[model samples]
Target: MRRVPESAEAARTLVRTALAAWGQRDLIEDAALVITALVSNAVHHARLESIRVIVTRPSEKCVRLGVVDRSRNIPYLRTDSDGDNTRGRGLLLVDALTDRWGTDRYRWGKQVWGELTCD
Candidate 1:
């Protein structure tokens, strides 16, 4: 996907459609939220040429979604709770909603993934 603000909505629509097909629509909201964060990070932070959003059903009990970008930068939760900070809170939302989340590094790029319990 192109690195743009609209990419987040595109990812959410893709996730919603895929989860609906898999009968896991219950995870749509959280999954959409996580993907938004993932795509935003890839676009704003990594500034990559392209980004890939993958939503997979590893099992009937879980749904895993990831965003891959052409950067090796690892994402960390920012603890800056200054009430005025407008950025750096995406991962915190992800952590609260997902069962587990982390990053994967590859030679060419990195993937940040989050899993949701659907069952």
Candidate 2:
């Protein structure tokens, strides 16, 4: 998808469709939020014409959602103890919702991903 704010919605749609198709409907809500946050970060920060959105059921019990960009910058949480800062909470929210989340740095770029698994 294009590296634009509107692409976040498009990413959410792709996640929603993929989850339903994979019979992983239970993950759709959190997955959508995860994808949106990831996409928003890439769109806002990455210097590229487009970013890629990935949605895959890596296992029958797990769904993986990711956003790929050409930026090597990794994401970090904003630990605002006072909750006064409005920025940097995206990763915190993603961390709260996903079973596991991290980034894969590559020669070309990086993939920031999160996973949801059935309990």
Model number with the top TM-score:
1
lDDT of 1 by residue, 13-118 (tens): 9999999999887888888999998888888877567899999989878999999988888899877796977678889988998999999999988999999998
State candidate 1's TM-score: 0.95
For all candidates, what are the clash counts? 0, 0
Winning model by lDDT: 1
Worst 10 residues of 1 by lDDT: 41-50
lDDT of 2: 0.88
Error of 1 at 41 (Å): 1.0
Error of 2 at 1 (Å): 1.1
lDDT at 78, model 1: 79
Off by over 4 Å in 2: 81-84
Residue-level lDDT tens digits of model 2 in 4-114: 899989898898898788777788889888998998889878988999999887887888899999999888876666567755778988999999999999998899999
TM-score of each: 0.95, 0.93
